[model samples]
Target: MAATLTRPKLDVKSLDPYTFLAVIGKRVIHPGGRRSTEELFSLAALQAGQKALDVGCGVATTAIQMARRFRVAVTAVDISPLMLERARSNVRRAGLERDIEVEQGDILGLRFPDGRFDRVIAEAVTMFVDRQRAARELVRVCRPGGMVLATEFFWRQPPTDEAREIFLGQVCPGMQLDQLDGWVRIYQDAGLSAIEVRSGPFEMMTPRGFLQDEGLVNAFACMVRGLSHAAYVRKMAWLMPRISRAVPYLGYILVRGVKPAAR
Candidate 1:
C-alpha cells in the first residue's frame, strides 16, 4: 500500500461541514452531480495514462473514478484530515491504492513541483480561498498545454438583497459566489487560455439531485442519517426551501482553462 502523501493538522472548522455531509452518507458534496463530472471529463477528454491532480478532493470518489474510467493516476489532496482519512479508506476499499494517492494539502499552495500533472481539477473549492491564487497554483502545477477543469456554484442571476441575506448570510457566512463572467475572468486573469464556463442546475442538495449523486440506496440512507441529528435536520429543512427560492439566481458552473504550451 502507498503511504499517505502527507498528514496535515486537523482543522475543526473544516471538519464540521464535510463531516456533517459524510455522516449523512453524502459522498459527492459538490453541485452538478455525476452527470456534470462526466461532462467535465468529456470536455477535458480524460484519457488513459494521464497524471491528474484533484485538489480539495473530498472523499476521492472522483479520483478513484478517474483511475478506473480513464486509467489515470490521481493525486487527491484536501486540507481536511477527516476528509483525507475517509478518502484514503475509500481508496483502499476500492483496491485502487496504486492508482490514487490521498494527501492533505491546500489548493492555494500545492506541494507538487512545477508542471507536474497532466490534468488538474478542483470542484467546489475555489470559493473557499483566494480564487486567483488558487487558479495560479492550478496552472503552475499543470503541464503546459494541459487542461485544468473545475466546478463551482455560480450566481446565475443577480441575487436580490433578500436572497443574499437568507442564503448567503444565514445559511453560509463568508461564502464566496461569483457570476459566470467573474469566474471566466478569474482564469483569463491567471494567464490560462481557452477558458470556458458552462452552467448546470443547482440540485446538489435536493432529493432528486441527491438520488442521482448518491444513488437510490445511499440517498435513502443519507436522509435517514440527516434526520437522525436534529441540528442537521433543521438546517436542511431551513435551507432547502430558501435554496429552492434562490435557484433562479444560482447555478453550478463547469469551468475549463488550458495552460499554454511553453514559449
Candidate 2:
C-alpha cells in the first residue's frame, strides 16, 4: 500500500464547512448523515460483482461501506484534492484499495463513458453546483435499467430570513437548495424513471446525531481533534452557532431513480 499521505495543513479560517469538518475528523458530513446513507443503500440493492460510482465521496466512508458490506466494486470521486487524499487514505486503511478506486472527478462532467456503471451515487453534492447538469451526468453514466441515487439538502419548511441568511449567505454561500418536489423534478427531467424519495430533518450536527453518525469512539476523536489547535477551536466556535441557526428549517432529501432500459 502507498505510504499514507501526510495530513495536509489547512487554513481553518478559509476552509468550507464540509472540508473544515472533514479536517477535524468528522466522518459523516451530509445533511441527514448516516440515516440517509442507510436509505440510499436500501434503495440501491447492491449485489456483488456490480460496479458503483460514488461522486463527491468524502473520505470514501460510504464507498468503503458499500464495498465491504455489499461486496461491490466502487469508483469513488471527488473534486477536492484534500478530500481525494483523505479518501485514498481511508480506502487504504479500510484495506479496500483493491475494491475502491479513488480519483478526482467533477459531478457536472463525469469522466466515465455513458452507461458505464450499475449504480451512480452522489451524497450532498448536486446542490452545490449545476443541479440539472449534474443530474444529467449521473443519469448518463448509469447503465440503462441501473439505479441513480443522490442526497441533497432541502427546506422542510420556509426558513426565517435570518436562518436563510445564516446558512445560504454565510456558511455555505452559493449552495442552491430547493423543496423536495423540485429535487424530484431535476431527476425526472434528466430522464430517470420510477423516481423514489426519502426525507428527514437535518441532524448531522445535533448532539445525538453527531454521536450516531461518528459512533462514540470516532465522535470523541473528532472532539479531541477539533480542539487540538487554536485555529480549529476558533473555527468550530464560529461554525456551530451559525449552523444551529439554520438547522431548524433544513432537511435532507434522498432521491433514487432507474435509467430506463433501451427500447
Candidate 3:
C-alpha cells in the first residue's frame, strides 16, 4: 500500500509476460488487504447489476472481487494479450468467468461504445498511460452522471532531496514524480468535474508485514523482469535509500469524478 519512493530502471521488456506474471503471482502489492473483504467491498460501493469497466485491469483480481462482492458485471481490459490471458484464468478460477469478461484493448482507445459502462475503475494503472487521453476514454465510455474511481501515485509535498536524487540519479534516467497538483491537472485537463481527492497512510494491511517488507521486493522483481540484468540492478540500488527512509503514509490519491450528463 505504500508508495514506491524510487523504482529501479527495470525495463520489463526482456522477460516473457506470462512468466513475469507467474513470478509476481497473486501477492502483487497488498494481498487481501488489512480490512476484511467486507471492508474493501464497502470502499468500492458497487451496486448489483451495474456494468463495471476496469481500465488496464491487471490479471482481473479487482474485477473478480467487484463481481463477487457486488454482483455486478465486470469487463476487464488490458492492452497486453498475455495479461488478458492471465486475468481470464483468474476469473475462471474464481468461478467468475461468466461474471467477468476479459478483453484485450487499449486504455486510450476503448473498443466499447459511448455510455457503455456505468462505472470505470482502475488501480495503479493510470500512471503508466497518457493520463489525459486515458481519462477522456474512461469518461467517454461511462454513462452520464456515472462515477470514475481511480487510484494514482501522487506526492503530497515534493519529494525530499534524498528521494529526488534516488529517482533521478539511480532510478529511471528522467522519471518524473507526480504531486497532488499534477494529478488534479490531469483530471481537469481531461474535462472531468467535481473531483474529490483523498489520501491515507499506506500501512501494512495484514497483521504482519509492511509494504517495504520482502513482499515489495518480489513484486518489483517480477514487474521488471523484462529489463536487462544491468538495468534491474541499478534500479534496485536506488530503492535501497528510500526503503531505509521508510516513509509512512505512502499511498495513492483516491479520486472520484463525474461525467456531465450532457455532451
Candidate 4:
C-alpha cells in the first residue's frame, strides 16, 4: 500500500460539484464520465512500459485503469490533499501502488522536466485555470512525438441566459468553457501536431451517465453513501437542479495531439 497522507475534513457545502461528487464516492467525476475516458484511452493507443502522467487525477481511477489495462507506469497527481489521500487509498486498494504514483501537483505549473513522459492526460481540468498555460504544460512534459490528451467541457450549442447563469454563475464559478473550435485552438497553439478530436454530450449527472460511469453496484453504493447523511443530502439537492439546467447546453471535447518530434 502507498504511504498514507493526513486526511483533512472537507466541508461538503463549500465543495465544488466535482469534489463533492468525489467525496460521495462517485469515482468518475469528469464531464463525459467513463465514456469520454474510454475515448481518451482509445486515442492514447497506450503501450506496455510507456510512462503516463494523469494530471488532476482525482481518486486515481483513470491512472489505475491505464496501468492495469496497458501495463504502463503512471504518475498520478492532484492538488487537493483530500483527493491525494483518496487517490492513494484507491491505488493501494487496486494493488497498484507499484504501478501508479500518487502525489500533489498543479496544472498551470507542473514540476516535471521537459519531455519526461510518453503520454500525458488531463480530464476536465484545464477549464478551471489558465487554459493556455495548462495546455502548454501538458504538451511540455510529453516527449517529442509523444501524445497529450485532455477532456474538457464545451458549449454544445448557444446556452440560454438562465442556463448559462445557473452553471457558470452558481454551479461552477471560475470555470472557463468554450466551443469545440476554441478548445482545438488552445492545444494547436500549444505546439501539438496531428491533433484529433472526439466529442459527446455532457452526461455526468444524468441517470444513464451515472449508471454507465459507476456501474450498477458502485452506483448503488454512491447513492447510499450520498443519502447516509443530512449534509450530503442537502448538497445533492442544491447541486442536481443547477446541473440539470445546464446539461442541455453542455458537451465534452476529448482533444488529442502529439508533441512534434525533434526537427
Candidate 5:
C-alpha cells in the first residue's frame, strides 16, 4: 500500500491583510512606498562596507535595495518561512545573492552576536510584536554608535473607536499599534540616544502609491491581482474607504536613534 503524504499546514496566524497584497506579487508593502524606503535608507546613512540587518524584512525588498543602492552588505531576516522563500527568490532575481543574505528569524529574540551590524532596520513591523523588546533587540544587535531605525504604523492622534476597530481589529490583528508619540517612546525606553522621527500618511493602497512603490509593470500586476483574487478583491472592497475615512488619524512614523557610544 502506498503511504499517504501530508503537507505542512499553512500558518494563518502569521498572516495579516498585507499577506494578501504580497500574494498578489506586490513587493512594496511598506507604509508609504519605495520613496519611503529610500528616504529611510538615506536617513540611515548607509554606506559601502557597512554591515546592515533588516529585521522582519518581508520579501527582502529593502534589503536588496539597500545592498544595491548603498553598496552595503545586508542580512535580511523574517519570521515567516513563506516570506523568507519569497525573499530568497527576490534576492536571487535581483542577482544580489552575494550582497544580501536571507534568514528565518524572530524579531523579539535574534540569534546574531551583539554589536553585529552597522545598521539595523525594522520597517512596518514591531507593531505586531512587543515594541520595547523589539527595539532593544534591534539596538542589541547593532554595534554601539550604530544606527537603528524602525518604521511602523503610527496613529497621527489617538484612534477613535471605529478607526481602532478597522486598524487594530481588521487591518493588523493581534498587533500593538501605537500613536506617534508612543512609537517614539519605545526607543526612548529602550535606552537609544539621539532619536529622530519622521511622520507621513499611509496612502499605500492608492493609485499614486502603486506607481511610486511597484512601478508600471508590478503595479499593473497588483491591479490585476486585486481583480482576480477573491479575498484580495474583497479586502480592497472593504479597505479603501474605511482607511480613507480613517486617513486623518492614520499614518506611519520613521523613528531612528543611535545606540549610545561607549564611554
Candidate 6:
C-alpha cells in the first residue's frame, strides 16, 4: 500500500477549553486507565536507571508508572496547577515520592538545566504549543544522544474542508494535528538527528466508547432541544456532538527522535 500524508487544518487555540475539561474529566472518571498507561510505557521503551521527563504529564500516570515499573527517576511537569497537584498526590500514593519529581510548568518554557534528562516523553502535548518552539524545548532539556518520544493523535487522512472546520473551528478549536512528514520536519529543524517516526493504531476507550453508545444519541437529542450559539458555552454545547462523532476516525502517531551523541 502507498503511504498517505495527512495535514490538519484546525486552528489549535479553540481546542483549549475542551482539552482542559476533557483531561481533568478523564482523571476524575478513570483514575488512570490501564490500557492507555500500558500503551504509553511500551511505546516509550523506558529503561531502568534512565533519567526521564514526562512533559504535559497529565495526572502523572505514565511518569509514576515509569518510576515504579522501570525504577527510573522521572520529572513530570504540566501547565495546569490542578493537574500537577493530582499528579503529586498520585505519585505519593504510589510511594514513589522519592522516584518522581512533580512540577508545574509549561512545556514551551521548561525550567531545567541544560542536558539534564536522558529521555523526554510527551503524549499529546506538541499540538498545544507553537510547533517549532515545543520541538526545540523538548530537545534542549534532553542530553546529547538521549531520546525524545512523542505520541500524538492525527487523522489517518486529511478531512474535507467542511469536515475540517466542523471538527476544528465549530467543534474542537486550537488543536493541531501533524502528519508523519510534518513531525519529521519539525524534529529535524529542532536539531534532533536520527529521527525515527512510526504510526500506529490507538485503542481508545472512554470517550470513544461513550460516543458509540445509545447514550450519545439520547444526549444529543436533549442538547438540541434548547441550545444556542451566542456564548462560548453555547458554542461548545453545539460542537460537542460533532466532535464526539469525529473521534473514531482519528489515529495516534508515535514519533521518536534522538539528539546526536556528539559532533
Q: Compare the candidates by lDDT and give the number of the best one.
A: 2
Query: For every model in order, what is the number of clashing pairs?
Result: 0, 0, 8, 0, 0, 8
Candidate order by lDDT, decreasing, is: 2, 4, 5, 1, 6, 3
List, residue by residue over 80-99, the lDDT tens digit for candidate 5. 87789999999999999999
Give the TM-score comparing model 3 with the true structure, all chains together.
Answer: 0.71
Model 6 residue runs over 4 Å out of place are 1-40, 201-240
Per-residue lDDT of candidate 1, residues 1-263 (tens digit) = 12221222333233345456765568888877787788888888888999999999998889988999899999999998778988999999999999998999999898899999999999888888889999889989999999899898888788899988776776566768898888888888877898877788788776678788999888888787666655566656766687777767778999998999999
lDDT by candidate, in order shown? 0.82, 0.94, 0.63, 0.93, 0.83, 0.67
Lowest summed lDDT window (length 10), candidate 2: 1-10
Estimate, for each residue in 168-206, the C-alpha lDDT of model 2 and write its tens digit.
999999999999899999999999999999999999999
User: Can you rank all candidates by TM-score, best first?
Assistant: 2, 4, 5, 1, 6, 3
As a TM-score, model 2 comes out at 0.96
lDDT of 4 by residue, 1-263 (tens): 12211222457789989888888899999998999999999999999999999999999899999999999999999999989999999999999989999999999888999999999999999999999999999999999999999999999999999999999999999999999999999999999989999999999899999999999999999998788777788889999999999999999999999999999
TM-score of each model, paired residue for residue: 0.90, 0.96, 0.71, 0.96, 0.91, 0.74
Q: What is candidate 2's CA lDDT for residue 42?
A: 99
True-structure RMSD, every candidate = 5.9, 3.6, 7.5, 4.1, 4.3, 10.4
lDDT of 3 by residue, 1-263 (tens): 12232343334335332223333453333222222223334545789999999887767767877899789999999887667777888888899888998888888889999989988876656666677788788888989877776666555556677755654444323333477778777777766688876655434222244343336665455545524354444543444354444333234566677777885
Off by over 4 Å in 5: 1-15
Better by lDDT, candidate 2 or 1: 2
Give the range where candidate 5 is weakest over 10 consecutive residues by summed lDDT: 1-10
Candidate 6 residue lDDT tens string, 1-263: 12211212333234454343333233311212344445556656778999999998877767876898899999999897767877888889999999999988888889998789999988778876787899899999999988887777677677667667776676546777766687778878988877666665433434543343215663355334223212334445655566555655556766678888776
